[model samples]
Target: MSVRRRASSVSLSRYARPGTPDYVTPPGDFCNAFWGLGDSGVDVLFARMRCAMTTTEELMSFWKERAILEERYARGLADLARFTIGKHEIGEMRGALDTLKNETAKQAEAHLIVANGIKTGLETPTLEFLRKQQQHRREKLTAVDKELKMKRNQEGYVVRAREKYEADCNRIKDFAAQSVLLQGVELDRLRIKHQRTLETVQANRRDYANFVRGLQEATQRWEDHWRAFCDGCQDLEEERIEFLFNNVWAYTDAVSTVCVSVDNSCEIVRLALEQLETEKEIGAFLRTYGTGNVMPDPPPFIDFENPDLQYDPSQPPSSHPANYPRQSHRFPTEDAANRNSVGSPTLSINARRASMTLFQPSAVNGRNGTARPPQAVQGGGSIPQSPSSQQRYSGGSNGSHPSHPPHAPPQQPPPPVPLQPQPQYPHPQPSNLSTPAPAHVPTSALATAAATAPAAPCPARTYTPIFFSLSPVQAIFGYTATTEEEFDFQKGDIIAVTATPPDGWWSGELLDDTRRQPGHNVFPSNFVALLM
Candidate 1:
């Protein structure tokens, strides 16, 4: 039986007397019988039965004696159960307390941060600085406003001045037009007066010239008649004195007529002189009238019919030939001058060929008797001679023309000139073509030196046909992982390997126990081998 059941049966035995009906124990009284037994009684029974007793009489000797002991035992059992329960409660409480403590600490830290924020906000000077800046901005705005107002006032004044200037311009334009009209009228009047004065002067000069011519003719006639009268007086004086007196009277009449003519001539001459003086004054006045300075003398008169006045025939053709007929003579025909130009020396074909041969002895002679050298034409070197020249030169006899007609015999060959050895001069050979001998080195040593000379480094080699290996997991993921330990391997671990030396380095992911989705797995679960 279990220890508690055994103990309870023994306690019931101690509480009951032997052979009693309670000792016999009815089926329903079994629980009560076990409850009436004390813990000491159970210990005693266990001792008498030689069973090991975990409870003792000392344990049952408390207040209420056996009953109190029983109560105490029950209380002890309840307290132990309570203690075991409290241990689990304490563990749960401790976990909750730890969580609460962490939350509290976080809250405390947050509060400290808030306090620091408040302190920082209170300490900063930005608001005061902003206020000063706003005041400065207001001052600048006020200055700008004042300047704008001044500018507006100046612009108003400028507008008023422009209006006044426009009015003045209009007035000036009207005055200028009126002044131009007045000036034209005055100029016309002056011109008319000048023309009238010019006509009067011309008329006066003509009248004066006629009057002078008449005076001269009358004077000459008077002198001739007086001389004739003197000669006649000597012959008629004795024969007829009375007739001589009448002749003298007629002579006197003639003399009086001459005197009257002279007086009329003198009056005409005086009027002409006065008119001429008036004309000169009028001309001077007219010349000074409009011009600011005295008028210059008119150009000297040119004769229209003089040889110098005639047009020069040697002048170049005029651009407007229709207006100037003399230029038509310059158009001469080329045919008219060609005969004169043709007499000048020009090369014939033979002459040109001869000249070419003289200058270039190596030129190929053509059938037409023209020597055309192989010209160094552009885009290439000299042109090749015709194939006939090569055949002729290649023939055994130099004087035999290969293409000549059968009737023509071969010409005799020129005699060979004797050769003389030229005097040789000791000249240095060019260094590039003439290799220098090695300085006293043995042949074997020279060969060894040549063999030992370092050759240029060969280009770096590259690996080809590379192969890769993957772990089992990597094969599922279509990727491979590099092994962390060179020798160790796991079934699911990824291993990135290559057959060829890696172009740079091999790198891949590592696989752990963590499960991953298909296609998401970066590492191989098992080793995989790949062939290139």
Candidate 2:
């Protein structure tokens, strides 16, 4: 009974225990029963699977969207690359065009230089040749005239020699005829005469021989000299002609070279112009793309008017105011309010005359119209009182109170006579001329004593106090002795120092160690010493 009761109690306790499986319920069956309710549990599982599938589909759609964007980005990148390549190509073409234009221009310039050189070379030789030819012609003509004059003189000398020879021969012939007819006393006389005739004949023959010899030598010399001169003249003429011909040839060659160079230069210029046109076209094209419009053509020539043409003196002058009045035109009458506002003199002619009357006293009584006292003219001339009169007149005219009466004449003060100092003369020397002993010793030895002589007390060395301020930091470091050091002090610091010699005091900073601060001494180091 106790065991059954214990068993019953254990059973009851086991049955009463919470969450214990009942003996009639199988675990598999219970699980099968709960799972078999497809309406709720299977619906929840299907819903979870459907949500996960939807998420996967959304992920796939997102990937597709990303792919589309990536593709579009790739296409854009390709387009940009193509654009960059196109720009690079365009730039390269432009550079090539510029280079070609520059090269063409350079070639044209070089051709022009060569052409100019050729032209100058051609012209210079031609001009020189012409000058030389003209000079040579002049020289040849002079030489020919000189030679002709020498020939004429030689012919004259020849004629004179022939006349002398003929006379001598005639005299000899007469003496021979007389000798043949003589006999007796005549024979003796004839013999002496014959001897005389023979002597005379001999002398005549010698003279004739000398004359003939001299003539022959002169003729030979003249012929030889003339022949040599003619030969020289021929050679010179030939050389000059040859030189001219050669110069002509050289000139022609140079001209031909210049012509050819000019032709080539023209061709080069044409080509350069074509290149320039092409470059301009390229520039226009580039500009069209850059600016979205064609550029306007520049004017062929600037229209400038002559600056000197603006003034036409031939035309009558404008009918403006002639000899414009000194007073303001706005105030036409003296009674106008603006009349005095212009500050111009409003006195009438009679009023000016009346003012001049104030000088009657000086003009009547003063010498040279000067009102100064007679003694004031010590230097032999009178001082003019015109300036004084003018001063008084001007003062009265421009004074604030225009209605005041004219100033009375000032009384002339007596001129001061400078007292001439009497000339001091030395006392007459005594016959002995004895010197007196010196009473004072030299002061050089007493310099120290003089320096120590209290300096006349110096009036207490008075100094005016000028207060200065300094920051706490600056006070710690002490005041800067100079303005430069003060300026260079750290930001928080302040400087205070007494500036001496207080009159007209000014201070400025020093830029460098060598630069002196105002009223300060620059030292060898970076320091500046204040000067009192």
Candidate 3:
């Protein structure tokens, strides 16, 4: 079975109505209200009233404190609004930001107004009314209590008056009895006593009646005043509740107004945000502060010892003067500094032929055992020889040995052999430039003539010139056959490696292609083994 439920009611407003002057009729005598239900009831009522009063007082105090906080906050916010944010803002952003600050200042002023309103219109009045209520309550209570005390005193007076009146009546009855029992002089005395007692009773009775009537009047007055005081106090309490309720409404209104003002200020900030052009600023910043459009060049290697010799970074590495030499197994000559590159106009390559015997001219490079002598070319002048070559070939016509140069070591001549007749060679004729000279000539006569010539030539024998593939050397040798590229090379590249010793070459002089010694001490020392 479905359980049906009532529809929920609409939520009540947070604000309450101010229902003032809730008149309540007095419960019996207002003065006796405390004691009517007993002392314990009085304690409970007092505690409840105290709790209610405290609640109201606390609410007022809280509102007062809240006002103080709002005032301080307004002051602080106003001061903060005076400062600048995003000081470097530009264009519309600048104007928009200024508007934001101005709007925020207005918001602060609104808050200040709200705080003042609470202080003057809510907290001030509520507190003042509470103060007056306390005083009025105290005064009313005092007046009621004062009247009650007088009424109680009147009750005591009435009791004494009754006692006095009854005592006087009893005394009058005793006098009457005495009058009935006496005669002559005693009768006259008794009659006088009786009249006096009667007179005293009448006086006491009138006084007692007056006292009773005064007590009754005082009670009536006190009761009336008590009821009025209670009603008045009740009105004050109700007024206090209504006043506080109204003050709460005022407080909420102030807060809501301030909140709306703050929201307006935030709306100004929103406008500022809308005017912001993030991309524009970012692009402008990059254009202003960026180094350049191109990437910078990488750092070049520099020599620690000669930093100034380093190449410029702006230039290509090829433009720098790093003329790296070619890597080769070089047999450097003794005059290394004087050595010429292969490209030099006159490159003199020193070669050595070692440990080989030379035959008589008649037996070496001869056709059919016939000898031919050296001849000068027709148009070309006599070939120049190095000083080293001249020293090796020099021989006097008189058959005497020549002395070696002082700096040069003495050469050990070949062991002497049996004399053989050397063939004679004819002198060259200019018209026959192409005529082939004999491969061999008389060593003694050729050396004699070479000594007299500008640079000596070797007595033509079996030795052959080792042809080099170098272009310049080929040109000198009249080789003009081909024009195609023969090789390629780069800086720091190796072109060729000269002869390296076979593994067992431990003690011999370096040799050339002819298998004859070139010279003593002509080898690259680093490649040769030292003798003990």
Candidate 4:
């Protein structure tokens, strides 16, 4: 066949022109088949190729639009999800805040109650009455002391009167002694007078002792009351302090929890937004087809005319020029490569073997199993050994043991044990003589057996529904008990719902034990939301 070659850039019309002998031979059967159909067939094929390329461009546009729409839709959904979650979180936080507020208020009320107790102890009526009574007792004691002193003075006056009377009686007795019988009468009068005076003095002393006992008793009772009042005040103060501490601590904890929850919500939102942004950015580059302004031209052909394209001396002797067949492979054969790879002068396989041999368990010096020192290789550095191997090698290097270094010289390994011929014996009979010989099983027999095995029935799972008792239900919503048996609970109180009725009422038990006894309560169902 005759052929004409032309530059690829030449116009197609020149080749198709009649009377011009620029006929080019087809490169292959495919080209020949298309060429046999002449101009129209080739034109139709080219038109079809142009249509296909146009369709591909439309497809690309459609996919790009689809991706953009999908991204928009996904973002919308994500935004909706985030909004929904944010709303839910906000609701939870609100509920938590409300609960915390209620709790704080309740604590404050409790603190007030303690404070009242402390105040009452300080200025209580009972204590005041006791103090007044104590004061009155002291006055009574002072009055009694004055009365006793007066009685003592009166007794002293009577003693003085008796002494004077006794002196008169003695003088009368002296005159009567001179007159016999009259002396006995005078002496008897004097004796009776002295006994009366002694009796009066003894009565005054008894009255004084009784007054002193009464005063001491009053003082002791007053002291007891004072001590009791002081103790009660101290106790109330302690209780107040304890309540204050508890309230403050609880408030602090609630605030901290709220802070953590807020932080977590913020982080979740940030992460979701970041993910959406990253996906939107990456969606732009998903399809790289036809993105460039112009496709790059093929790498400039070999440039055979260049002066720098001199023969490479390092290349294999059989390397061929472009357009020429290669007669030699680039890499050595696998077996040859493997054989020389380890023993090559650059690799130093012998040194590695020497290092490994120095640490081998069996190659030891006698009883202690010490490692023999590694001999120096042709390379400058000693072979690197593990710490344990180095220690053993160091221990044996002292020349105390008769062991040779690994690289000192090559030595033959001990010959393997020779195989001994065994005496022929009949194989043992099968354990089950009556049973037929077992058939051979395939390698997949175990798997097949498992696959064929009947599956066990799954046991039914018992799911226990968790019941939530509202904590601080009233603080979050309104609730009123309709029955006499139902207990009315305040804020920060636990309300346990036992059942819900269709009548817009729910039957529940009050768990707030402080103000009311725990019992059933009927309240509107809408009074509280169900906790998740």
TM-scores of the candidates in the order shown: 0.19, 0.25, 0.39, 0.19
Candidate ordering by lDDT (highest first): 3, 4, 2, 1
Question: Each candidate: how many clashes?
Answer: 14, 1, 9, 0
Candidate 3: list runs displaced more than 4 Å.
1-60, 91-103, 131-143, 159-208, 274-277, 284-532
Q: Candidate 4: misplaced stretches above 4 Å?
A: 1-98, 117-124, 134-141, 178-532
Each candidate: what lDDT? 0.31, 0.35, 0.47, 0.36
Residue-wise C-alpha lDDT for candidate 1, range 94-125, written one tens digit per residue: 33434343433343333333333322332122
Whose TM-score is greatest here?
A: 3
Candidate 2 regions with alpha-carbon error over 4 angstroms: 1-158, 171-201, 272-532
Candidate 2, residue 5: the lDDT equals 34
lDDT of 4 by residue, 1-532 (tens): 8886553433343335455233444422222222332223334333333333343344334434543443454444344433322233322343444444443334343334333433343224334433443454355434544544554455555555556555555655554554555457776776676566566655555555555555555545544443443344334334444544654454454435444444444434332322222223344444433253343444444567888987555754333233455343754454234333332221121122222323322211223332223335575533311111111011111111011111111221122122223211112221101111121111112222223334333233322222442222321232334333344544344555443222223345555444543223444333233322
Clashing pairs in 2: 183-187
TM-score of decoy 1: 0.19
Q: What local lDDT score does residue 96 receive in model 2, on the 0 to 100 scale? A: 49
- TM-score ranking, best first: 3, 2, 1, 4
